[model samples]
Target: MNKPPQNSAEMPDYLKARRLHLNGIITLMGDMKKLNARANKNAKVERLTIDAIAAELDLIDLQLKRKCG
Candidate 1:
């Protein structure tokens, strides 16, 4: 990753950024999932990008869930 992930919530802010990140990731994953479901499942480039995003999202979700971090 070119940029380090930013965390804005500290003390008074408290998990605000993490929660928002989690939510946004979830929304994106859901949209990707819908696309995956509707997709032809045969295109190489399309499948590759979708798979990559899904894999990355899974990692982020696991980290947020305290299963990987």
Candidate 2:
């Protein structure tokens, strides 16, 4: 009989951190989407804030992949 493959559930601290960071980025993106839907064109500040958040999320995703890989 063949044994089941091992899971990465036992990953190290760094991997865990990366996973958490990725989750945070996703959550932030969801929030930004909601805000964008309600925000009017005159809301320049809100648009800028959303743009910054998106940039940060991209950076975090890249960092997480680098660290986890």
Candidate 3:
């Protein structure tokens, strides 16, 4: 597992940017999810993307939790 910065101040620029990008993706995914639900479409691609992003966020959260706790 990749180690996170010990603190917010210690985080690198790239990681910060990455987190922001991923957060934006999450927002867009939310819209896509809502649209898919309304249209009753089988959004396999969207589902896969959501799963991948969730997995990545979970990993990052686990690392951050370890650093903080």
Candidate 4:
């Protein structure tokens, strides 16, 4: 069976921004998961680790904005 295509909603600017931010977080999380799987202890504490941490923080901020605004 074939699947139906998704429709694009006319979302507000904030919602669009939130979606973009959340997508970025998901991508970052996936990258982090891969890094954690393949990397040793030293790599875990590198710049990529810091980037993932910052991405998590940004995700939290976006979530809060979504909830509060």
The top-ranked prediction according to TM-score is 3
Q: Backbone collision count in every prediction? A: 0, 0, 0, 0
What TM-score would every model get versus the actual structure? 0.41, 0.44, 0.58, 0.39
Model 1: per-residue Cα lDDT over 1-69, one tens digit each? 234336533322333344466567667766776787767455666557657766765665565556323
lDDT per model vs. reference = 0.55, 0.60, 0.71, 0.58
Full-model lDDT, candidate 3: 0.71
Scored by lDDT, model 4 comes in at 0.58
In model 2, the runs with Cα more than 4 Å from the true position are 1-42
For every candidate in turn, the CA RMSD to the true structure comes to 6.4, 10.3, 5.0, 8.9
- lDDT tens string, model 2, 1-69? 233225544333544555466567668766776777865565676557657766766775675567467
**Which tens-of-lDDT digit does each residue in 1-69 have in candidate 4?**
223224323233444465566567667867876878756566645557667756766765775566556
Misplaced by over 4 Å in model 1 are: 6-42, 67-69
How high is the lDDT of residue 14 in model 4? 46
Residue range 1-69, candidate 3, lDDT tens digits: 366556666664435556667889989988877867776566777778888987887776665566456
Instruction: Give the Å shift of residue 33 in candidate 1.
Output: 13
Off by over 4 Å in 3: 1-9, 12-17, 35-42
Q: Which RMSD does model 2 reach against the true structure?
A: 10.3
Q: Is candidate 1 or candidate 3 better by TM-score?
A: 3
Best by lDDT: 3
